[model samples]
Target: MSDFLQTRVGAALKDAALAAVITLLLASIMVGLRTKTEQGGLVIVGQWGLVAWMVGVVFVGRLAMSLLIWRGNNPVANAMNAMLPKQDTVSKIGKLVGPLLLLFAVTLPFYGNRYVIDMGILVLTYIMLGWGLNIVVGLAGLLDLGYVAFYAVGAYSYALFAQYFDLSFWVCLPLAGILAAFWGMILGFPVLRLRGDYLAIVTLAFGEIIRVVLLNWYEFTGGPDGISRIPRPSFFGLEFTRKNGFADFFGLDYSSMHRIIFLFYLILILALITNFVTMRLRKLPIGRAWEALREDEIACRSLGINTTNTKLTAFALGAMFGGFAGAFFATRQGFISPESFTFMESAIILAIVVLGGLGSQLGVVIASLVMIGGFEVFRDLEDLRMLVFGLLMVGIMIWKPRGIVSSRAPSVFLKEKKSVSGDLVAEGEG
Candidate 1:
């Protein structure tokens, strides 16, 4: 009995087998069949082969992970980590990565095809949204499940203002952000006393309320059909028209690619601004209060910090950036719809913040790229797409539960600033 209990391989095998069986039971029905429209009708084609494939992948991944965690028997893992570069060297490389990635993004429009550029725009938009949500969920330890409300508010605000007031995109941009922030404050006020799951539920309800209002307010919001042909932003008062467009003004031949490139740059700039402000805010007294609030609310109050203002500012600032991203989305798409701002959008943004590392700006970027760009990469997987994605997410959580960038540099420090592992920080669930 002692020998059996001591066998790590036996334990790993048992655990992996149990996990595989559970996964098979839960996911088999959905993954093992496919619906295809035939001349006769919809056909339920058997995809048992893919089902087996998915289950096998999960089994192998779980086995590997279990072996790695076999009661302190993973010397390979410890040695590998020990062999990695020192923290200081890694920090230098991390600094270079941001600049190098930025350079690549800036140059992509010039060399990449249209599809790549479009994906870049989409990725940057999510990056911006993730950073915005980081303020509330990451820094302030507020769990907001319905952040898309602010995003919808921003998009519709710009669309309505432009349509009724005849305002250009430039004029509507800040106004949209302001309106969204106003709504954020409104949300903040009601949920002030709430925390944890209660706060999340209320925030989720707020998002649904906005969505329902947009769906039903047919006269004002255009209902499910959505408002279309939103005025696109011009290049500094110069339209994208072929006659006096940006290309013509610059003495270059006109091409539709100009608009795509412009949108890419616009979103990139917005993302950078969001990143910059978030970084600066991390050092401010208000920001420190946010972190304090995140770490321990009771302690924060005891330390003379205004918890109400801290939470309100977190919500408002986060919503403001979300509004900015939403405005860019509306202009880039030339349309606005409630469907585009669904709970799934909020979930994805939150996932980025969590999967990256709460309150880590660079982590948000890496997670956004992996999640958003990787979505396009796996589009071809079809029925197995989600199954594959689920497996990857499970693996990530097992290996790096705290996130990829698990260390956080303190925003304020009495001595030299030292990197703190994210494991020490609160998960920011509330």
Candidate 2:
């Protein structure tokens, strides 16, 4: 091997060792030693096997990743890459996948069991939030780490209104969205001049502020205990109860599955609406402005585009959809809590947007399914799930930061019909 290749392998080995050491420390502290109650007495037990397994996985994963990186440009790999499909072909395949996934989602409840349906609901909720954040972070180039605050706002809005005013879910749904949008604009005002890490800090602080308020103001937000027994959504004034309910109205036997199915369809419709609106907006002038702002705010301003309005609109509309999803979440769970709206929620949503491919709607759907659905599959490995996922995320950030869907179709094309590959436009410049 060449000296360069030897150096690469050496660096890879060193990095893998470092990663293994770090994993050993974390796993040992978190899982190696644990407390078990024996006869009403707390006993410290050692689970060294689990810690060893974690370290082994980390070392192997990091070493393999390093080797892959080093081999990426080899002649054999180049030949294999050449044999792969072209960008246009891949884009066509992505388009086909979107419709198929939508069809599957629409028909899922019929074939899926309760657990499957519940996971579907959770996945769809993330998809909706991903699409919403896509408007700001993906299109407008704003870094919003506090996007979940709007989600909490929408949930609490519905919960409070339903509890105090006896409002229907339908009524509170729009109100919740509007309230969340209002808060989105409120967040927008403070960080108008901020960009990059500064922008992220402000947004993160905004989210924490919202959470702190919800946590401390026990009289209004119910504090950490949260608000429970919130009303469930009925179909056009039809309850899901035993008598005069959905089944009785239709002369069918009542089943709790009815509500689950309703929520499934309800969220599906809302997500579709969000998708349609975003697609349409992309064709409008404002949508193009968002793309311009994302590309280079200074140039966008030089072109006489009002940056202030563009940013505010992106924030407000994004927050609106988040609120919509939040309202649905609240009604579906019949509870609202500060714990549900944390910084981690924002990170996960942003991760979906980043991993899926910024500004690619289909990418968001694909990534949400992989990340969210995959998380469920690894539910048994709760101890190592986050560690493994964090490592995977780190690997992606280093190797494939452009995301799974590295190519995206342009919103606007010339009369000559030019093509724009997403790689031509690097994301996160803002």
Best by lDDT: 2
Per-residue accuracy of model 1 over 1-430 as CA lDDT, tens digit each: 6677568887777788888898788667787777899998999888888778878888999998878744554786787677878978988888898899999999999899999999999999999999999999989989999989998988998888887888999999899899999999998997978989999999999999999999999999998988898999999998998897788899989999999999999999989999899899999999988888888999888988888988999999999998988888899888788899889999999899989988888889999999999989999988798888788778889988987787888876787988887778886547
TM-score of each: 0.86, 0.84
**In candidate 1, which residue pairs get closer than 3 Å at backbone N, Cα or C atoms, i.e. clash?**
143-430
Error of 2 at 168 (Å): 0.3
lDDT (C-alpha) at residue 302 in model 2: 93
Kindly report which residue stretches of model 2 are placed more than 4 angstroms away from their true locations once superposed. 1-84, 416-418, 426-430
Candidate 2 global lDDT? 0.89
lDDT of 2 by residue, 215-268 (tens): 999998899999999999999999989899999999999898999999999999
Candidate 2's TM-score? 0.84
Report lDDT per candidate.
0.89, 0.89
